[model samples]
Target: MDAAVNTPVVVDSNDDGTVTQELELEKMGSTLEEAIVETCSMPLENRPRLPRITLSKRNRAVVKALSRMLIIFLEASRDLCETDLILFGTAMAVCRIIGAKFSTAGRTTAQSSAIPAWGIIIEERIATKMDGGGR
Candidate 1:
């Protein structure tokens, strides 16, 4: 899904005496979108500044894919710490993406390269969403 499928169930008491569980898709999407915005926009003192040659053409698409994946993972998760684990786990993927996007002819080792592309990944991720393409 292009948008996040998470927001979980909301328990609300009606003006009457009935209680209900509401699956508010819009609310969930907006809330998750906000969370994503907050997470991505937080400033890092040591954030890397990738050169123009190192940027990905698919920055927006890749970030959309990754965010959707994260939402799916978050929605399916049971334990809270799993969320933490899943979030932290993307570090490897980000490095791999950086390596692949800016590959040198034959001298690049993403595993050992010190490119510091911690994002453009994150920047591109949130940047595109808030730009013209995102909902």
Candidate 2:
């Protein structure tokens, strides 16, 4: 293969029976060439794209609450495996990344509640929105 300029080749076919060939060779590094060939040779169907997330606010709040619960479970419970901590850390990271905020602006009736009542309230609000206020 002869090294040609870095221009994308266009192969045009005629309606009438005629054969035309255009090949462009690129001067790429050994690793890059290998990578390109490997990537190109792979079946397009097998190369899946990332899935989109369409999370509702209630879902976000639930996820956040679950993360908090997991953290609590990890902290309060004894004899947790190293893997549990890893999972908990990952969940915490995700909750923070989504930026699920809980309203702590006002003192609630259950302000002295020990079981993260604020987080629960936020989660309820989120759940309500997700459910279209069904309840």
Candidate 3:
């Protein structure tokens, strides 16, 4: 996926003659929701199968509520920094890319396989963040 094409860029000019470019990930949330819905609606045989994971309705409701709360928090924060926006954009992009890869793999392969690349990438990111004290 081309970030330039898929992501929306917002340019902010400060009074100090500095410019900041922020990528808005909220816009991609709706598209990701649509993709999730479409993936869920696929025929049983066409969809990827995970053996042990299950999200209960209550858990899902909680997740949805928390997601809404997070969005609201992001909106209400006047001190929102570029790093926050960048992290959100990166997270959304990773999710979408992983989802696309899984969907493609489901269509091309007979059996579901572990996403080692994405898993390793996420682990490394987490480790880096931890090492940097959540910089």
Tell me the spans in candidate 1 whose CA falls farther than 4 Å from its real position: 1-57, 100-135
* Model 1 C-alpha RMSD to native: 19.7
Model 2 / residue 91 / CA error / Å: 0.9
Best by TM-score: 1
Candidate lDDT scores, in order, read 0.42, 0.37, 0.41
Write candidate 1's Cα lDDT for 26-91 as tens digits. Answer: 443344445444334433322233223233333333333446546775786678655654453343
In terms of lDDT, the poorest run of 10 residues in model 3 is 14-23
lDDT: which is higher, 1 or 3? 1
- Candidate 2 lands at a TM-score of 0.20
Between prediction 2 and prediction 3, the one with superior TM-score is 3
Candidate 1 TM-score, true structure as reference: 0.29
Q: Write the per-residue lDDT of candidate 3 for residues 1-135, one digit (tens) a residue.
A: 433222433323432322132223344444444433454455535643322223543323323433543554355446645334433433333344223222333333433344567887888899999899668
Q: Give residue 66's lDDT in candidate 2 (0 to 100).
A: 38
